[model samples]
Target: MADDQLGEEYTCRVCGFRYDTPTWDGGSGSHDICLCCGTQFGYQDTVLDGVWSVRAKWAAEGHQWSSPEFRPPDWEPGTQLAQVPDRWADASVLAFKLSAPPLPAMRTSADPEAQRAEVLGRFLRDGRLTHFPATGREWTIVLEHIAAGFEPGVKYRRLEIDKLLKAWHGKPADLLSRLTDQGFVANDDQYYWRAER
Candidate 1:
């Protein structure tokens, strides 16, 4: 899909709010926080499923203005949502990857902790993982770190799961799907939680 489909160049992917600047630039999010749904463009509103989850939450919460200072007196949710392009509304998983910047050369250490730290340093930014690691060992480490965020015995609603994973990666649904497939998380149709694997 064209990044600016339907003349939505400055539109919030999550709430469809128009902004002065483009939400995405050169395949990366502008990282501007949305005034309507409060979605941080590069973070919570990155992928399609994640965007949908944010929209759903905003709607469920009565469509409150995220930035009350900028909210117009006559603004309505239905009208703004109508501005969201069909590309976002009709899609399932729009796995849009923000361009991953190149990292410094690294050497694996003999110490397990050091090796893990190196892997994390390459993949994480401000506690949020930038992308899935290419190596199996590094990927498993990242997955385990993410799984640690959830409690083992407590069930989570789908929205709750999405929220928890939102800070971890842009593609929460994909992350959950991978976690479930690997038996790190289990779900019984509706509820999900960390599995005792």
Candidate 2:
């Protein structure tokens, strides 16, 4: 017989254990052994009263699709075929497991802008910056802490500003653009300085 002509599912008759399809080497290995008990499987021993052949059993159950049915049932208008594999787990549990994500720690700050700045400043002050990290107030309120850190009458290089934001994993160019647009910071191609009043 050809590989495609075999029954995709089989059972261990001794222990009534169910065997799944595609057992490694396509369907050939599916019925070769009982996985639960390690018992050597013998398909011929399963035949009862000379009526159980793999092809014949599957065909009688309307499963073997390769050959035409030798005994297809006579059906009336409303006759229903019996359902196979009667019980299985609900899919919702599997779907939930697939879709769920791990939760992050909850924050309680009421001010959205303040909260964003706090989160943004965390990596900035973790000793990851050569510009020196300011903790406490700086970690809670970013813009003021950053502005105070800038020296008066001193032009800060764009590279320094880049290092500042890069320490926090922020895009330096984008932050400069946003700051300039808000009229609270001024910058050219090479330098940035606080325009605080």
Candidate 3:
């Protein structure tokens, strides 16, 4: 079936609003309800609450709807875009540090020690560290030591993992294990290389 035919109709379960396949606004697909009320009616409206809600949810989830011509829906031509501050623009690259690492299936707990063990097990399974030093004060030491070998701006080795774990001293091992398990780095004979997937 054609794409337009597939998504041509939508009905509001609450209000029983119904619209034709092709709306006057050239909306790709017709919705199942009157845009104003939750009821299904046989017409289109200038404003659609259901459509707006879906759009808002997509934006909140950091997604954009697919369109042949991509542009901000409400933005008009000749409106100058706002300039991003240099510091703010630079900070976007650092946002990856805020993300949780990908690890194998393991039970996580509110208890910090249990979480640490789970993360460490994942790390040992997925990561290979050539050098295992004794007498560790904090797991941060290990992460920093591993991060030391990579040069800045090379690739996946951002070296911010240590900084990110600074706030959670008791959970540094968990954080380190997560990073290693995620394949952010590879240790070879005391030297570390950034692992890119």
Against the true structure, whose lDDT is highest? 1
**Residues forming the 10-long window of minimal summed lDDT in candidate 3:** 77-86
Ranking of all predicted structures according to TM-score, beginning with the best and ending with the worst: 1, 2, 3
lDDT of 1 by residue, 71-181 (tens): 666666665665576567633212212222222222346899887777777778998988665334666678877898898799999999999998888899988977887
- Which of candidates 1 and 2 is the stronger one according to TM-score? 1
Count of backbone clashes for each model? Answer: 0, 0, 14
Q: Which of the predicted structures, 1 or 2, would earn the higher lDDT when compared with the native?
A: 1
What TM-score does candidate 1 reach? 0.44
> Against the hidden reference, what TM-scores do the models get?
0.44, 0.28, 0.18
Off by over 4 Å in 2: 1-140, 188-190
Q: What is the Cα-based lDDT of residue 119 in candidate 3?
A: 41
TM-score, prediction 3? 0.18
The list of candidate 3 runs beyond 4 A from truth reads: 1-170
Candidate 3 residue lDDT tens string, 127-167: 44422221121233445534545564444323454544444
